[model samples]
Target: MTIEEQIEKSRTSIFKAVFPNTTNHYDTLFGGTAMQLMDEVAFITATRFSRQKMVTVSSDKIDFTKPIPSGTIVELVGGVKHVGNTSLKVHVDVFIEEMYSSQRESAISGEFTFVAIDEDRNPTTIVSYQ
Candidate 1:
């Protein structure tokens, strides 16, 4: 498949309900928890795109534009943004949706970098077959 096709095919999206256990005293999702979920989505996108073992190396500026309250739903969408010889970047966006309404808004966005790794844990080419 073409690079563009591969990128599109690897896009990942995950949905979760915001419960009290995952929220802070303010009843909003915690920043750390959001970051963890973003990283997980990024990891899945990177691995799907490269079809190789991938490790998160860094997370770029993450902007929390809005608070995600408990009793709401959240959708985390991840897509390949950039690809290099041995690494790639995935952009993740968190969208909040009300359980009772059709309202949805972007709450957070960030970019994560991942490096493809071999069985020996060494950096390898992202697109080995290509």
Candidate 2:
């Protein structure tokens, strides 16, 4: 399917983690925290397609385009990009909204691969819901 088709089946969410007053000296969100959220976003997208547990097998590429200030809002959007018999690939993008503004800009984006597994943790085919 085309990238646009994948995007149409995408899911997006906004998440925030409190950084106590002393957590940031520069008053910006920590890079590590941002990455954690990014991973979750990717996982969620893949899991939605699998309807089961998903583990990140690989990250194709992750590019950080900007920094997100501490008090700003973070948005993570993810969707399926491709699917094989037992594997699904998801693309996730992270964005940040300014404290006093609604504008959001891309902060980072990555692609993750997940393999479907059964209760025994063995690889299994991921059926298409479409």
Candidate 3:
């Protein structure tokens, strides 16, 4: 498949309900929790795109634009942004949706970098999957 096709096919999205347990004392989703979820989505995007062993190398700037309160739903979408010889970048966006109303907005966004690895855990060129 072409690189564009691979990227489009590898787009990933995950949804979760923001419960009290995952929220901070202020009744909003914790920043750390958001980062963790973003990383998970970014990892999945990288793996799906390369279809190989991938590990997170670094996380770029993460911007929290809005607060996600408890009792809301969140959708995390991840897409491949850049691909290198042995590394790739994934951009993740977290959107908040109100449970009782038709309200939705972007709450966070970030970029994560991952490196393809071989069995020996050495960085390897990303092989295009059929």
Candidate 4:
């Protein structure tokens, strides 16, 4: 497969339902919870793209554009944004959808950097084996 094909194939989307337990007192999804979900999605995408043991090194600015109320469904989309020799960047976006209505909007977005590691947990180069 080509590098473009690999990147395209790495695209991932996941859906989650927000419950009271995962929300704040104001009934909105917690920022920390959203970040955890984003990081998970980033890890999966990075692993899929590199086909190696990948670890998150850093997360860029995360913006919460809107509040995600409890009882709503959220879709987290992750895709490869940049590819490097030993690391790559993944962009994750969170979209909120109302449970009983047709309302939907972007709740949060962020970029995460992941580094490919070997068995010893040292950084390694990522090569696309076509």
- The number of the candidate with the highest lDDT is 3
What is the TM-score of each predicted model, taking all chains together? Answer: 0.97, 0.81, 0.98, 0.97
- Can you write out model 2's per-residue Cα lDDT over 8-105, one digit (the tens) per residue? 65565756643554234668667667667777888888776667767888888788788666667777888787888898888888877776877878
lDDT of 1: 0.95
lDDT of 3: 0.97
Best by TM-score: 3
Q: TM-score for model 1?
A: 0.97
Question: What are the per-residue Cα lDDT tens digits for candidate 4 across 20-115?
Answer: 999998999999999999999999999999889999999999999999999999999999999999999999999999999998999899999999
lDDT of 3 by residue, 1-130 (tens): 8999999999999999999999999999999999999999999999999999999999999999999999999999999999999999999999999999999999999999999999999999998866
Q: By lDDT, is 3 or 4 better?
A: 3
State the weakest 10-residue window (summed lDDT) of model 2: 15-24
CA lDDT of each prediction against the hidden true structure:
0.95, 0.74, 0.97, 0.95
- Displacement of residue 104 (Cα, Å) in model 3 is 0.5
In terms of lDDT, the poorest run of 10 residues in model 3 is 121-130
Residue range with the least summed lDDT across 10 consecutive positions in model 4: 121-130
